[model samples]
Target chain A: MQLSPSLTQLIEALRCQPGIGPKSAQRIAFHLLERDRQGGKQLGQALTKAMTVVGHCQSCRTFTEQAQCDICASTKRQDSGLLCVVESPTDVLAIEQTGQYQGVYFVLMGHLSPIDGIGPKEIGLDILENKLQQGGINEVILATNPSVEGETTAHFIAELCHKYQVNASRIAHGIPVGGELDLVDGMTLMHAFTGRRTVSQL
Target chain B: MQLSPSLTQLIEALRCQPGIGPKSAQRIAFHLLERDRQGGKQLGQALTKAMTVVGHCQSCRTFTEQAQCDICASTKRQDSGLLCVVESPTDVLAIEQTGQYQGVYFVLMGHLSPIDGIGPKEIGLDILENKLQQGGINEVILATNPSVEGETTAHFIAELCHKYQVNASRIAHGIPVGGELDLVDGMTLMHAFTGRRTVSQL
Candidate 1:
């Protein structure tokens, strides 16, 4: 039987998420109808509540329920003149999961993909510049993913940081541990050789 | 940075769906926060709308916006005095996709799993029996899956149909076309051999 228009629409909307194909979407659609009516209600409520209540932090651009996100507002974090920059709130979450980063984050909201018409203004590079001018950040770590677009975006930010007389460095990329010689690609193999560290002889 | 309480809660709630692992759920959570704000809002609206607007059809037991589902209410469909009973809406979708059947359906919504404490009343089998009795269905097609639980449930329903004096038949089972002998399990292979069709010699 045909599903109700609202459920059909909901399933359609759900399909926009990554990896949610039509069949999976339909399964989830029917599942919501079949079991956990309260969860279905909660899904609706949470979506609405999050969209309306949560917004990007003005300072770091991370998602916040109030004027600023918890990280940006926190007193415990080392404002120790360090800030890690990333492309999205999910990236922020990924970094947070590591539990190694005590410094704050600056979310670009997106990268500098000029071909797609995405530029500095679109990704809020101006905000990063403004935050730099405000002082206190001694080191800016370019934690964007190691892709062509990400590298180009990082270079653009690094150049801007140099212009403002602020120290900046991109996150490192090299051969992974336990990588075999035969499995390594040409460029990575060359880079790994060049960047190899000296080992103490027995 | 840690997500806000609402976002954290949203991701937690989205975990109930099949195949949505933590990472996928997190991605969807942040994706809703980043892009498609309107889509997110619409999803919530749709969920609430579907939950409040649609309910189970009394006759067929399919979830419907109206008292009777569209399939059951349709005048175009042939009411061939036969009813096909299946476990869930997913099963209904599967049967509809085949496009081979002309008659309508009766959704059990779930199977009788006594170990899980699911009984006739729990899955509304009693309601289905009443509908079948009132409609005077000449035949009842048991279209449940071939799983042990499904077969057991089908047989239980078949016994009830026989008691009511309604003709009941199980859907056929055999090796699917394009299926390889090596991959075919013993039970299916046996069925395929037993139910082999006669062909004219070339």
Candidate 2:
């Protein structure tokens, strides 16, 4: 069936979202035009404003309206000598939600994917290296995902920390806190067994 | 963690889409600002344009950029005297996709939900009554859904047709074409049995 030109354009534009398909795009377009034009206008204005004002934080590569993010600018965080590196801004939010980490963060934006031509520079690793080489950091934590590319990226960052003479640590890999052992995947089971610690350490 | 003001607004606006929640909205907002700013701008423009241009079709109440929709304006559709009444523009699209029906359509936009303060006038039943009373119509097909509200709406429309002395027919209720008998819901099974017809009728 033929749609109006503006409707077609709206559907096509909506397809740029991560999980949205043509069907979903069409549904969203119709919904906006039919039921929620005011909401649609609000969303459009918000998008324009965000695109205009939000940019990568100069210090940590997280999204921010200013040069440095709130976390990077704050003096209240206790562990100023420790840095936690992650693959994305979303990961930073996830870690922060725990309320246990007092250190600052470095966002890589993406993992190292050689097949996709994403190298160290593409993910802001050079900036991280520069931060480490400035000589005040005591420890570096690798908090990338458990994927192969994440592992490669973490190893590369670990080597950089070693060269800078800073201690390096990887986030533990095992069954999640609420997960059943029988349901845990084989790779995670093996990692858990190998990374097991004494009761005193716990 | 606290997000920038514009970033927060963008995330809130993204929740206007059908299934998106807080986490999905955040992900979509970040994706637009970080990776697909150009696409986001295009979407914003499309939304603005669509909102400015599109309005309800005069004859059928479907979304259109003009006074009449493409289907309503077309001369090739055979059944001008047959009106298929349905509950939303999306349902009109669903029926049109079958490529079987050549009749004109009347979009109710909603069902008769008195509890929600939606009565006959709210769903354009008055306009439908006027169309039926004008006397060219040979048949009115009740193509509303099979739920209780849908049935109530369909029956109401059928009564309107009877008042105008125009023929009224209900869309058949039965097992879906590819559905397994054992897997069909009890309500649908009862509807199928009750709606059964002779082979010669087919």
Best by DockQ: 1
Please give, for residues B1-202, the per-residue lDDT of candidate 2 as tens digits.
7989998998888886886778788888878876889888888888888888999888888888999998888776524688899999889889989999888899998899999999999999988888888887899999999999999999999999999999999999989999999999999999999998878754
Q: Can you give the lDDT of residue B71 in candidate 1?
A: 84
What TM-score would chain A of each candidate receive against the reference chain A? 0.87, 0.93
List, residue by residue over A75-132, the lDDT tens digit for candidate 1: 6664567889898887887788888888888889888998999999988899889888
- Tens digits of per-residue lDDT for model 2 on A113-149? 9999999999998999899888778889999999999
Instruction: Give the runs in model 2 whose Cα sits over 4 Å from its true position.
Output: none
Residue B100, candidate 2: C-alpha displacement in angstroms? 0.5
Which RMSD values do the candidates have, in order? 2.5, 2.4
* Native contacts present in candidate 2, fraction: 0.71
Question: Which 10 residues in a row give candidate 1 chain B its minimum summed lDDT?
Answer: B73-82
DockQ of each: 0.72, 0.71
Docking class of 2: medium
